[model samples]
Target: MDSSDATPAASAPRDPAAPTALRDEADAVLRGLAGETARLREDQWRAVEALVAEHRRVLVVQRTGWGKSAVYFVATALLRARGAGPTVIVSPLLALMRNQIDSAARAGIRARTINSANIDDWDSIQAEVADGLVDVLLVSPERLNNPDFRDTVLPKLAATCGLLVVDEAHCVSDWGHDFRPDYRRLRTLLGDLPGGVPVLATTATANARVTADVAEQLGTGAENTDALVLRGSLDRESLTLGVLQLPDAAHRLAWLDAHLDELPGSGIIYTLTVAAAEEVTAYLRSRGHTVASYSGRTDDAERQAAEADLLANRVKALVATSALGMGFDKGDLGFVVHLGAPQSPIAYYQQIGRAGRAVERADVLLLPGREDEAIWRYFASLGFPPEDQVRRTLDVLASADRPLSTAALEPRVDLRRNRLELMLKVLDVDGAARRVRGGWTATGQPWRYDTERYARVAQARAHEQQAMRDYVATAGCRLEFLRRQLDDEQAVPCGRCDGCAGPRYDAAVDPGALDAARAALGRPGVEVEPRRMWPTGMTEAGVQLKGRIPADEQASTGRALGRLSDIGWGNRLRPVLAADAGDAPVTDDVFNAVVQVLASWGWERRPAGVVTMASRTHGLLIDSLGARLSEVGRLPFLGRIEYAPGAEPAPARSNSAQRLRALAGAFTVPPGLAAAVAAVDGPILLVDDRVDSGWTVTVAARLLRRAGAAEVLPLVLAVEA
Candidate 1:
């Protein structure tokens, strides 16, 4: 939370005379304060000064509770005294802004926020900002993108613009723990300002790659920047890391109950999902532990109440998602229990960093299970794009010399826009492509693909899995393995882990017990076939007519099915019928694509359609067709009139009606053709009359694929699809 409560370490401090240019500027600013500025450590003061004096753009990288805000607060005061005008601070969270504004008010400085609550009065705020009534203005990047504010309010403030500070600057970098697209536009917006405002970027965490990205996004080239790289010693010697590989959720809860009294004064239990957070909190409550739960989905007032309770120690332990600790300051947290594996090392560290803030010994307990990895794998699979799709996308980009807009290139690629965007980002990370203006460009260099990134994300995950194998498989010290992963040198053999705890604890139990239990619960077996059919049904008769209808003439039918079926035609018919054709077997790929397409549309096979009628006869025969010579035409690929008979009108309908019907026609093809198309094993192309909703098609395709269809393709007649 603050420097007063930070743990003391043995790391050497930077030299006092080590290029103190930035230090001198910060000192000058602090000296101008009317009242005493907050006292800071020598190292903190020096880092702040160097940031102010030397770097036109500086990135402050410090650990939590390291007095980061003091550096900027001092600089702001000094700048205002020297007639540098008002400063602007951009943050992503409104709560963080409110906290900073409150802190500044306590320090006797004027600050105001231009967030959702007060944005309606922005015009008047702009006048105050222009008149120098406001010393600092806090706003989120989303609001800054507002056209009116950019065109009107920003220009007025530019006259006295002194500093452009971005807090939590790591959000600007894609590699950062939290990446936001709105942050990307800030560089462009600020660059357009009348005066060249110097920028300062600050964050508690950033690796080398993230640092470089932050510089680029801020439009500050690396050559012109200075970094105050403070390596927060990872040596939290007072904290013990314990990992348990439980057999099931019940077993994990049992372990928690056994260790309840052993837990420190107050603790935070982190869960991966909102459901888990609620479940764990309820379980704890039932067991007589005062607990509170916090998650993103919880209402704001409830979240605030939970946070207040946690801080007041009214709740002995708090079960929460990763959202509880941002900008929060609690000095006496004793333990951080991870209910499941976190996504990454960065996330784990951020959560664990909440504990031991008061320089006291603490504990971090990690409880994982066999199904945890499967859960993580499922999420990873969802995030990863199919290799074939990625390759196809890459090939399309490789063929062009210029970058392509994602929208313009969608038709040229098979993958959806959002999925494609993620794939491109992954490619960029792998150096397969470099993101350019508006799109991505191939680097013409092959990337060494590492499948590990596609697996578990956190270092803790890999460590824990290995530890589990070593303890349960090879019989080793679990505590030692955890200490090794955390870089702890003094970890003695703890006689606690299953391995060290001896035969009674290490006796092998059937790992398949949970699976057996699940099996006994009567879980339904996989049903991919039905799933595939429900999304996209087949009609062979529909196919024959599809080939017969001209693309242009079909385009205006209002529905794709209507265009293919000639649903509303009257009796003034010139029957140009095609002979019966036999059904062909469909391939797996075609079936899958079609299933996907059908799933996209909400169509399923029913007993009453053309396919059902054809199936009853075991084959298809020639029906009837006609052509009208009207001005309206169908699309190019609807079908072709390779040959048609010049037949006379068959019914009482007048010739005028036939003339008015533009190329309206129909045909009867074999029932097997539609069946074959539907039955294709691999993938499917879904053809629909009209796409009123894409969800049905998507769902159907997913079901079909699960049912053993290789692929599904959806072809919809209208844009509604």
Candidate 2:
């Protein structure tokens, strides 16, 4: 939506230099925006006055639904009234940008957003902003580092931009729960702005350290000044907090399925992982609940549609991941149910704040799972790689004669594409690399990898995690516990929490619903889609392969009993494949599960021989699985692909080009394996303990295909999601 239709016609702008005049106009804007008679709270007035009166940087650390948007919308009108340039707000999510745009329109501030969601409209929005018609412009943090935007649009915006607002500002801190390298680029924008331009940063979730870090970063280049920090209690008085410890995922699903209709109003149901969100959404839909799944993996159109559905109360609840966090406005949301605990109490508080915003009381339920800690650790593992990896990445970029794309640099570095891109953005923010037309070019500048700083951040994250664990088990008031975690000095025992009120809700799941949920979770077999195209720049990695993988060389669609994220088999196999897990023969339970998977697989041709990839630690398990499958099917048990002694197989790489390069010549068919494959004269069942990158399976299947196996069918116990 453009600003022209969203806003009201201007009625002669008001004076901004007078604080009293600004206050009167601000209250009018707030009343219009909130859709009721209202006056600004003392803290909000302080923020507005600081921005309009003194033109200083301000950081507002208040809970959600605290009218933080009103302060900015009002400030934008006042600032623009005095002929200042449009307010530039860097939001962290598309859903949030959309909500803010609607909110700004309510206040008669002409607002428009330029994000990945609306690429075709960006030129129009930019044109409108240039013509001084748009009063406020919203963009995602990632846009700040986009190659074209940084080189072309950013300089123009910085030169003419009036007020800067960083929403979800906690992401600026490395220690924050939602730390993103893209948000850190704001320092450059803050530094480039003229001294008198007001800047505001707002967030609902941040501890003292994160608050200080954000405030310090808000006024980055101003040596002698600090941002005006406005901190408020994070307690949500309208929320009735409680926790329900479910025995298993199925039980939790059953509870939701049974009680969803009983919930007061349309709200949100949160899951820890995308898989769980999808799974829960599918199950609830099967039970005839009008729900939608929202996660990072959801398409842009679908995410927008889901948000609209929830806003209009079309769906019962949106089963979502943290992708639904921050800036999702629902004034009368009835409840928020988290299927699993977030890694930090601050994050949990922020998510639940979405509910009960305009209502008297909304239910906030936490269903702690047995697998929550595992999920937390899985995400924690994705933090910044070691100093050596960063140095190596920079060194590779520095030595390149021309700008190199991430695909070309993949083989030279071991980091995954996502992590590598994050590092590149961080380097770009630090001025150590520049994203030019070709791709990325390293600046010939010395950059120190902050070992100690990252270590401290990691330590802080650990403390947050422990705090979340303690939150679930705390005997004190849940509301007070969360507030205390945010360092709210006014935190006290809230009589509305479960602990204080002595369990105000029931924890029971209907017997029939529980049975149905069990049946749903028990049903196994996940389709493992094969890799169709080869990774780009494989030739640069010393593999002669490039371009589309020959159809004959590609592995066919395969099957795994379950994903590593599944609620059913995931819990059982997680320990089996864990880093410290002991290697042993497949248990009867896993073997039976695999047998069921194969029975229902309905492959065009049955496996005539069993082949196993030479395993590093799970050799015993793989051998037993292959041997047992061969015996059961009465097929030949072909020998395993041999790993040359002392030759390291690709060490579980995330980058495809690097993985393919590392797997080159790492596996070879044994003396009799080719003869066995030819004799079988049909599909070969390639057994493995697990499949992650699917590179190992690809390489092994390619070898068997060339060795005369008619077809290759990969069967694994678990597949990493």
Candidate 3:
């Protein structure tokens, strides 16, 4: 049952004493039959020949669509002729595994996947491997991690394994562009195999750090490994990189609409959030674009359907989060648009690589905005654990001999499970600890309390954050920076980037615009009163301006003023003179008149508050004023507005009936509420705050009109209901 006994027959060789030119012609004949000689570049062909001649593992780090896979596919044919055992390729995606298997089958080589869906076929697959019938076995990391499968099957496969190839091998390194925790265990798994198999790792994106990490992870020391770190030329002469600065969501949507028709063939629009993906997909679909959407929430069936539609050209474009692109091999994609900036250069590379798969010219569009940087910063902050927390976590783990589940460790570390999980993953990557079974354990050495471990983690996290910050702030060639980050030595200036294109702010600000805004605010109209001016939620700086009027105006005048502010007519007003100005013609008489009307209507102004309104009606009036203020805030001198001091009006509260009615009007209630209203369910009335309108009382009455209400009387400090 020995592996060599069952191995395939070695092909006949040309004479060893033959001239080099004769041997080259013989090699060309074998390559021609495989149809690889015509497809491969001269350099690529030379690299492959050298690999076969030396029988040494080769690492090819070419750009996407450079025929990297052909190098290995052709090598597989040649190596088989030389009596090499079956090639065992480890990939992270099932789709890629299947694709590779299909390609091998086209080349008349036997290939199969040993993955979750085909666990039942493992026994037969193992037999084939043992009998030396399987030429290539493509398995995912999950398959290797399967204890039962690994214990029984891998040992047999290892005995006969040759040419161990790891596709997207950057996943193995923590510092790699894309790091997977499962990939961290690959080195151990490979080391455990029989006969110390030769390893070849390939990826389109890997920097110097990633290369070094890959070398170490594959047990090929940096200096000793036969690594061909090819820096592909960044002169994608046919492709154009465009960066669009979107000032707001509306602008972004408009841009998408304008460009929807221009996009031909299959394309992808990447968004930062699932909701954004879904929303954008819906919007695009409404505008007559055949679109499919993918996000983490998309089920397996839905994902498959969308992916199929994309591949079949049923959908011309797909709106998705970053989760959709890995392992996707769509050859005809013409564009990749980022609805927002990608998280990192690594991510951008992978996403953009999805396009131009067939070597056709393509384009990548980046919609850069402040929100993009914010999202990356938020994620990076969440990824890093504080040094104190890290130290405590390590101490707790070191104290435990057996693996402790996250729930059990939570109490010990005084952190939530989600937070602890992230911290643990980071610690594992930094070599501080290892995830074992259901929990984590300290590695060989306890993390030194005073050492650079904590500093290194912090520095790494900071570096990632700074990378994102630089992307947002840099006024340089975006493509060049991206290529440089990926170690592409041939990178040249991309004339299409924002910096190369032109200055972003070419339009001059018009003073007339400010004057128009001021006139719009100051004209006879309602005014919105300001609330707390600082820390308004999620709005741009210029949205708060509006017209303001003296508080002493007639109630009808005040209402009219508030209405004007609500409709955005009075957004540019400024209070140049105080209401009590001695030189003013209207003087305190106008101010007093408005004050009296407000007080009578239960709307009062407090000395210290922005504008204290006693009721929701008055609050609504203030909201209107704030909107106008936002416009006026843009003016240099007119932006400064001071609130006049005044006495607080008595609080006019309402009964439950009034409060309930208001809530009902504001929100859509279920049919259960209608039935409860008819039944007059006398739910205990609880009032923590004052209700000014009688809407709550009216609503309760409507409910209790059918149901019995012992008493609908108000029970607050003051009642208007």
Candidate 4:
């Protein structure tokens, strides 16, 4: 996607008074990129000249398809021609690297990438870089923290690299919509670079705050000169943006069902969660639409195949998560429809910007749902841990005799695996810890929590969320609102949006389509597979458990009416499962769904007695569910499993080992329950309000099985995804 139209490239030719030879060479490179007709935009040539002539740090902030990739590729060609080493591009995603590699090849430049997916090629790729056989080398931000690469390959590259490119530069700032801790490590590499090694940081989603932050980081080299930040208007001329607020999840799905193909051409349908992506894909496919699901949950090969299918226009759309957001280059993608609104306007703009890149007109719409806030809160809950949690992680690392992997550290710290890894990466960036060959170790360096900065960041996030709400609610131009959110001084009414020009998409859904959507979403039941093995390092966490859970002690694969993340029952279940929600019996609506799930379960053995797992929050709900099931099935009502005195409930969102440790001896079967289980001839139904970590059920099932029940089948209202 070259910046051939409405860009500085079309503004004017380079100053004739300046060196014309450099501009001519840059134009030749551009022509190779597109065709014989391709020419460098004025700013594109300016950027190349700065790197090749002035050797300056630079930040280019332009909308998607404004030819950010062109500048780097052109500079790379010129630099290699003048006896410079390979350009090292710190990209954020593998898809972006793949796209850039293909784009570079068009300009007759050699490119190679090193990431987790291609470990086998690393040695050969590094050798090529060392031999000056590669013009460009792309690596993910996470690669910078890799022990072997950081210790060996990085230092060598820093000393010899001609130009360093930081793509998706917004990730460098916590103020940015997508802040990645690993990107912060570029400071170390920047400081170690040999003098006069130019650097480039480019992003389309950064606001004034993020741009300033990235520029400051880019100029940290030995010269310490200020980076030239060239931020342009973010308005996309070809996009017609609008918001079509739907009453509920079903209505939104119905709208997509009715209007997906009528928009423009083959495009992407963005969902906020993996479950939503899959759900939307299934619903659209059921309605005879050709589409596939793409998310982090998708396997690498499948994701590649889906991407290829979309590029070739073999499918109408690919329902996706933010996994498809940055660096996906389909020049003629006709539309981008979000199933729900993102929490930030900057992120929303970046996503919708994927459309109309090369086309004269493209539709960009948002089908905001009532469930978006719940999803937002779910993600916001994963922010940086409290100060005490950070100190606990540091103390554990400092005391370890040998480096401990994230898995080993999981049991010692209270954090979940993903969050713990994120915190560890942040610590690595702050110099309080270092990732070594084995895992991570404390540097014993003093580190402050920076409470005020963190608080400010949190406050900024809240403001962004409000801005998104305003973008949805405003009667003003959609594109103008987005541009203003990015601090574009040129923001104004585009005269092309639904707001400025009037509604382009009807809110009405076809009656038949709405019915189909309702039926699809109304369908219930998701399998809740029982825990089969204990987490590693359980013994270190003071639990003797380890290895595969004995089959006889394991609970049979159970069932939940639906996932809390599901677009269907999730809306219904969220309110009931909320922390502030009062304890009560399961609603008739939910109970009927539970009955439908059980009637369709088709368990191998039907004989069962009902049992309840004591819930501190919803004991009444659990007891009622068990009693109703017992009465409905005509099975015995076995007594509840009581928590051992003084054993507090396990914390929410704890890792497997920590959860298991908390539950190991926390439950005991009363004498009556033991006798009843001994007399029971079939499996027992262990009831609970919901399941998060699943250890509570595992422990309770083990206790019941030990008391002589033939099997234990767990049932719950909702399962956390």
Pick the TM-score winner: 4
The TM-score that candidate 4 achieves is 0.97
Identify the superior model by TM-score, candidate 1 or candidate 4.
Answer: 4
Per-residue lDDT tens digits for candidate 4, residues 345-447, read: 9999988888889999999999888789988887887888899999999999999999999989988999998889889999999999999999999999999
Local accuracy by lDDT, each model: 0.51, 0.85, 0.53, 0.89
What is the C-alpha RMSD, rounded to one decimal, of candidate 3?
16.0
Q: Report RMSD (Å) for each prediction in the order shown.
A: 16.2, 4.9, 16.0, 2.7
Model 4 scores a C-alpha lDDT of: 0.89
- How many clashes does each candidate structure show, in the order listed? 82, 0, 30, 2
- Per-residue lDDT for 318-359 in model 3, tens only? 898877756777777788888777667766777787787764
Which candidate leads in lDDT? 4
Stretches > 4 Å off in candidate 3 = 1-37, 115-133, 142-146, 149-155, 193-196, 220-228, 384-454, 457-461, 464-476, 494-721
Candidate 3 C-alpha error for residue 391, in Å: 6.2
Q: Model 3: which ten-residue window has the lowest total lDDT?
A: 564-573
Q: TM-score, each model?
A: 0.53, 0.95, 0.61, 0.97
- lDDT-sorted candidate list, best first: 4, 2, 3, 1
